[model samples]
Target: HREAHAMQKDWMRQSGIEEEEKAPSIDNFEKIAAERVHLGLLVNELVLSRELKLDDEKVKTKLAEVTNAYPNGDEIRKMYEQNSELMDQLKSTVMEDQVVEWLTERSSFNEKEIEFKELINNNQ
Candidate 1:
């Protein structure tokens, strides 16, 4: 579906309808991949060190949050519920969020709003 969306957008762009997208470079992709790996390691370490556990309800909640955007959301959700691989992936993602929340709760940081440009610049 993502590939299909991109193909549609590309055709629109060629037709002079859609605006050019600002996708980052492969170098940025590598950086982001590394950062994700580091985060996954940190989450795992904390999970083991703090003895944190995943809640089944969180996975269900995450699934609902994920599927609610689609047209046939309820149907997709039901299908996902019956798929072991998708359920396992969702469970892992929920655990990652739970671990991040645990870290955030114990840490101190100032909250400030920034522009979209600034956010993208910072990421780059």
Candidate 2:
């Protein structure tokens, strides 16, 4: 958590986003973190969009798969269709996912196996 907070603060400074007058309290950290992550995704999507064309049908299909995981999937789908804001947000998320997938496909990485305990200890 401390590492995450530090990273968030660093990102805000580098991205020219101003923090509030008060320090971010524990109660608001989750919201702040979510906003930071969302902004990062948007930026990444913008860069990826310039390099690769996105298909609207793929976005819709992914959204459908996600929405169907919920019990009220039909209603949720209707809500997105009826609300432009929600629909746009869904499209943005789907596009980001596509961008990530594309990048992953082209990237190479070395997998290092580590114990769960070691991973937790390292993070701490």
Candidate 3:
């Protein structure tokens, strides 16, 4: 366990990810783990979409829907419309979501349920 902790620290250093001054709670780590899993799924979906030659218009439509769902959605949409960088980021995120939807329609997964505690411990 000590070696693993050291390796994690080393990896953070190598990746230029700074360690927090205070250790994160288990819940915080769990949240991080969940986000990593989400990102991994999106990456897998993006690869699948590329292989299938999928159109990205669905993503754009979804992004518009999402923006409209927000409170002050018009202002939000205007902000994105005015800011190229934010617009690009929004587009990328929407594209990833679209890919995930397409992949879900075509792929099957084997599933097993595990306790959240077990999931967190196993990740550690």
Error of 1 at 7 (Å): 17
Candidate 1 residue lDDT tens string, 1-124: 3434545565566777644455333343455456666787888898999999999889878999989989999998988889988888798899999988998899998999999999999999
So what's the TM-score on candidate 3?
Answer: 0.43
- How accurate locally, in lDDT, is each candidate? 0.78, 0.74, 0.67
**Residue by residue across 1-124, what tens digits does model 2's lDDT show?**
5545766576667777686444455445667667767777776766666666667898789779878999999998888889998888787777677777877888999999999999999998
* Model 1: CA > 4 A from native: 1-28, 110-124
lDDT of model 2 at residue 23? 47
> Cα lDDT for residue 25, model 2?
52
TM-score of 1: 0.60
Per-residue CA lDDT of model 3 for 1-124, tens digit only, reads 3434544565566777785444333344455566666785767666675774434676567558878899888887788779998877676666566666777999999999999999999999
Best by TM-score: 1
- CA displacement after TM-score superposition, residue 65 of candidate 3 (Å): 2.1
Spell out the clash pairs found in candidate 2.
none
Of the candidates numbered 1 and 2, which has the greater TM-score value?
1
Of the pair 1 and 2, which is ahead by lDDT?
1
